[model samples]
Target chain A: MQMTWREIVTAVHGMLFGGFFLMACFGVLVLLHRSLAAHGGSEVKEHGRRRERIFLILMVLLGWAAVLSGAYVVYPWYRAAVPPGVTNLEMYPQRLLMSDPHTAGWHTLGMEWKEHVAWMAPMLMTMVAWVMMKYEDGSEEHRRLRAMVGGFALAAFLAGGVAAEFGAWINKKAPVTGGRVITLSQDGK
Target chain B: MSSPREAVANGAAGAAVLAASLGCFALGVLAVAGDGWKAVAGLLTFYRPTGPLSGVSTVAILVWLATWFTGNRLWRGKTVALGKVSVAAFVLLALGLLLTFPPFEDLLLGK
Candidate 1:
């Protein structure tokens, strides 16, 4: 089955956002586990440790996938679509957004938000991963590190949330269009 | 059973590493101010320079530190190895950021 560019981009966006949500969920789970392990039943402590280890690993992997996939799609599309003469992104949002130039303003803003926020995910996720690796659960040192890492994870998740929302908003508000063919001559090529 | 001094030192190092990673993220955002979509896209990658290099470095260094702390014999000499790699990667990331700015791009690439 040959999917249109719109279909393909949408599918990719779905995968991208799905990764973000999963990362957020797991990040929160790991953080909650750490909290519960501090002053809870032994069973819950065991459960938190297990969940922290497993979910942290998953969150790290998904964060990497989202970062790479986002870069792979956004970069090439930007280069190919925008012509040389265009000065600003706002000037030619149609090319970047795959929409009519007339109404590409909001979509352009959304893309900007998506790009900036998406960049925050990797650093935060990796830091949390590093903390998990560095410290044993339930120790004095581990608790300190976990608190810091948990904060980073929360921030990363928020950024991912914004990026995903802006991405969805852009896709829906300005659904991708079948690109136009330009000709040099006065008439059809 | 680490002494308080050792714990304090480790915490300091971890905080520094986290700061460097955050610096890289800030660079990504700042680079976008000068260039446009290309800069934005470049800064979003896991590769060297204007993007995730510091984050990558933090991860590598942290992993080595963690393994060392945990008495993992296999990662011996990783400290020196990672330090060298990080120096090179930071240089590249700096260069990448410089090039992303249009003025620098014009100077280096030549319009």
Candidate 2:
């Protein structure tokens, strides 16, 4: 089996970074909900607090990694221009999708929306992480802070979901292909 | 009694949330601007390969950092009214989210 370099990068961006970011979003949601009891107060211990900070920091890092890889690494390949007389647009995802009317919406709606929306995830998550780091108590004041940041976390999750969904659908419609190929395994003759 | 350092304050959290929302809103506004205006699009092309996206994201991030630093500096250790801050932040965030939507953007630009 063989896979192109771009394919691997895209896979890493999607399956690894994007996938883990989504899971982390969900985990933070649950963690925050439990941390701030509805009646008021938190049950998180000191160790748990440290662990939470680590996770949130990691989540923020993952969010940035996902968007940066997608925009800088994979997106350049996706939006690469097609040379004249090159009828095969296989290497150009944006052009490929736009070539057909039926698939045009994939680029216009899917990619346009995904590229911009994905960014909200990291910005909001950064805020959520910093705020979580600050409010380290179980008082009513801290609980309200947790609840507000929890809402921000929920928004971050939705943005990530939208981006991942569109990224998957767009790639399926016109995948980014080309670049040096690597053989996964050699055949025994 | 809890010491000053030990007191629970909403200033930092408020600052962060507000700054993040402003950054997001800046991104949404720039996205729409870049899409609607050719001059804006060309101006925002910091990286030729990445088009306006690189500039858009970079500027928004800078705006976020600036606002966060300023807000933190001014609001740190002060217990500002969080309810008002939360309302403004969420509203800005909602508008930002709306502006980034393709259909909504089109509606604004008459595209």
Which candidate leads in TM-score? 2
lDDT of each residue in A1-189, candidate 1, tens digit only: 244564465456545544555556565656546564665334235666687677667766766666555555533343244567775554233364545665555444555445545655555566566656556445554465455556556656666676677666665654443333333355443
Model 1: which docking level applies?
incorrect
Residues A16-118 of candidate 2 have per-residue lDDT tens digits of 9999999999998987887775454346678988898899899988999999999999999999988989999999999999999999999898899999999
Model 2: lDDT equals 0.90
**Model 2, residue pairs in steric clash:** none
Q: Local error of candidate 1 at B84, Å?
A: 26
Which runs in model 1 stand beyond 4 Å of their true positions? A1-6, A16-30, A33-37, A40-51, A82-93, A96-102, A176-189, B1-9, B12-21, B36-111
Summarize candidate 2's per-residue lDDT along B1-111 as a digit string, tens digits: 123432466687889999999999999999999999999999999999999999899999999999999999988877777778888999989999999999999999999
Query: What lDDT is reached at residue A40 by model 1?
Result: 32
Alpha carbon lDDT at B92, candidate 2:
89
